[model samples]
Target: MEYYSVDASGYSVKPRGVALPRSVGDVADVVRWAAQNRTPVTARGAGTGLAGGALGDGIILDTSRMDRVRYLDGVVSAGPGARLGAVARLLSGYGRILGPNPSVGPYCSVGGMVATNASGSLSLGYGSIIDNLESVTLVDGRGDVVELPSNRHYSDIISGICRRAGPFPDTTKNSCGYRLDAVPSPDMSHRVVAASEGTLGVVVGARLRTHPAPRRRALAVMRYADARSAAADCPRILECGPVSLEVVGPGIMEGYGGSCVLFAEFHDSVPERGGPDHADRVCGDVRRAAGVRPVMIREGIDRWLAGRNAALSRSLGMTGDRAPSIIEDATVPLERLPDLFDVIRELGERTGSTPVYYGHAGSGNIHVRTPADSRVTEWYLCEVMALGGTITGEHGDGMGRTGFVRRQYGEQNHMLFGLLKDAFDPHHILNPGKILPA
Candidate 1:
């Protein structure tokens, strides 16, 4: 029970029962039973979610047993129980890759990625789950089996409700309350379900779009004296088309001879025989190229990438008692990267909490760790929203950011989310009190 109670966020909730379903039919039976008894059902993956999306007070549906990966045309269909690493390994054999990857990597589950619209370092060139998802199979709160995209009647019904939603934030990544605005004219259920955080239904399986693996790649490490200057130069650097552009804060990268360093990579369609590759210029910052130590080998690449993935867990450990602060995953538009860095600095000064800044620089999604109260962090959120940003990106508005979603999307959108909620789970027993008011 303790194992099911907590997630990476440090948030905990005791579920009534833990169900390990081995098949889709078992999952459906559990959902139906929960629906009949008026008990909430929370679909859990590897429990690697940082926002407490999988922790709730009812039934915990552990999808680990049903993990299976199958290839179908341009997409890979997998059970929600499938681990992200297993899917990646399966696709590696075919020279294909999942478009949106969570930095959590192997620990994250396919269902959890879809549940949070997860993205990673290369999300700039690829996209979030909203773009790569093909379809999903789910069991709503009411115990009804539903396959979105295949069920047009309910799709139109939910679309009618979602039509009244408010405008979305003007940023690259968002995982706030019910992204109704993402639903297309004909209603793309897969997109709507991606960031809903299990409020609408329990994800059983998903078909995700895949991309062909790049033939050759080059990586360059760019150092900047000032963090903001490093961010400001991102626009020009992006012009050079780096498939992956990620920032590393001070102390995060040692002996790099700078306060901050950016990892940039470019890919080629075919293997390089010899001569100059796309990573030659370092975005024309020739002085920066003096430290052009590239990660041409597998060991260096894996070691450095490990540091990037460990940011969140490391921050949580370093913060002591003030570990689980709310100033996390504040994403702004690429043009406003400088502004975000400035705001994070101000937040550190005001709250007296250590601020760590690093993320998908190309997408302006910076993860800030400030040891402050949620109420105090609201100030940063307002500033980002004013600059056309999102309060939470990739990390869903679970226990941490649920209170701020109202202001992020306006009250109209919240009302629409309620209407759509009724269409799927009338009893509100599916992941109750998540992405919505309790």
Candidate 2:
């Protein structure tokens, strides 16, 4: 057991003991041990989670050594401790890939991504972890290995709970609730675990569905006069068929010095018999129709495949010393994105703050980051919710955004979340104070 009073971001939070569990059996044993000792347990992955989901005062079960990969059919069962990048590289050989793509890249574990319901720029096409999850093996508080979505008894229980659940936001990507929406799908049980934040149960392993790698790919660097131009161009660009379409605002340009940038990428498994001229023509049409211009157009098949780290570093500029303290992943309707950008700029004025903005323009999900400080920190949470948006859109409402959950989720949904947390962790011992307010 180990203890820490400081967070990775340097914020202080005291934990009693940190347990490194070497296997799934170890995870179960730890949970039972904690239950018997009347000690709370919080499961931790690589601690790469921006939210304080991994930070708490209790027994921290570090599952880093539980990493392993076992492929069966089109499904890959990876340990909760496995790094996403390592999994991505492993699947590349088989011409398959997972759906969720956090900007933090492959450093985070699959369990962490699932916990947050994470998605990246490619989420425009790939969707989220909820879409990719085939099944999960989680150790419940009673040390029972329950495979969710299966066992009709559990589904019946979940159905009843959801019927009584609160009204959730009508958005594409959300990680706040019990994911009641996921229950109706063929993979309904998978919903119970997605974005649970290790509160409901500790995920020992997960089975993920994969897709064949896209064949031909093209990367386009489009320049906009302002966020409005980028916003206006989103709908038109979608018509051109893009696997990844991301927008970077003035803050990113401040570092890169390109007028409001959009990184557009298209991937198709078909061979490029006629080159990317067709895609380029579509891009040109989108630019012209939207009154924007593209700076560079790059095309490749499987030839120009750089590793995940190279890709993520390029998107999130390397600051060397510290990662940005504030980052946002707010999503809105595609039609509302242009207005959303205007609102964001308006927020900058109100808060006297400027954020580095970028994200999935195709999916209407954008990321914003402000400098970390005490001044104006308190109001930031309210301001984000007032805009009729989520404090988190893709990365999730972990401890970083949990404080703002009630505001974003509203009273009904927020209360439902509390009840769900109570059902999973009646003793309030597992990852206490995460997802739900204390």
TM-score of each: 0.92, 0.87
lDDT of residue 203 for candidate 2: 91
lDDT at 209, model 1: 93
* Model 2 lowest lDDT segment of ten: 301-310
288-378 per-residue lDDT for model 1 (tens digits): 4333333432125657777777766665665657654653787888888898888888888888865866788888888877677766777
lDDT for model 1? 0.79
Q: Write the per-residue lDDT of candidate 2 for residues 1-438, one digit (tens) a residue.
A: 333444333345778888788877888888888877778887877777656677778888888888898766778889989998888888888888877877666788877877878777677677888888888888877666777667565566666666765555555677764676566643476676788888889998899888777655666666677888888887877776667777776644334465687776776543332354656664565566455665545544223223221333443453333433465567776777787787677657755566557777777777665554444444654654555545566666666767767776677767767766666667677877777765
lDDT of each: 0.79, 0.69
Enumerate residue pairs that collide in model 2: 85-106, 149-189, 215-268, 215-269
State the displacement of the C-alpha of residue 325, model 1, in Å, after optimal TM-score superposition: 3.2
Clashes of 1: 0
Identify the candidate with maximal TM-score. Answer: 1
For candidate 1, what is the TM-score?
A: 0.92
Worst 10 residues of 1 by lDDT: 290-299
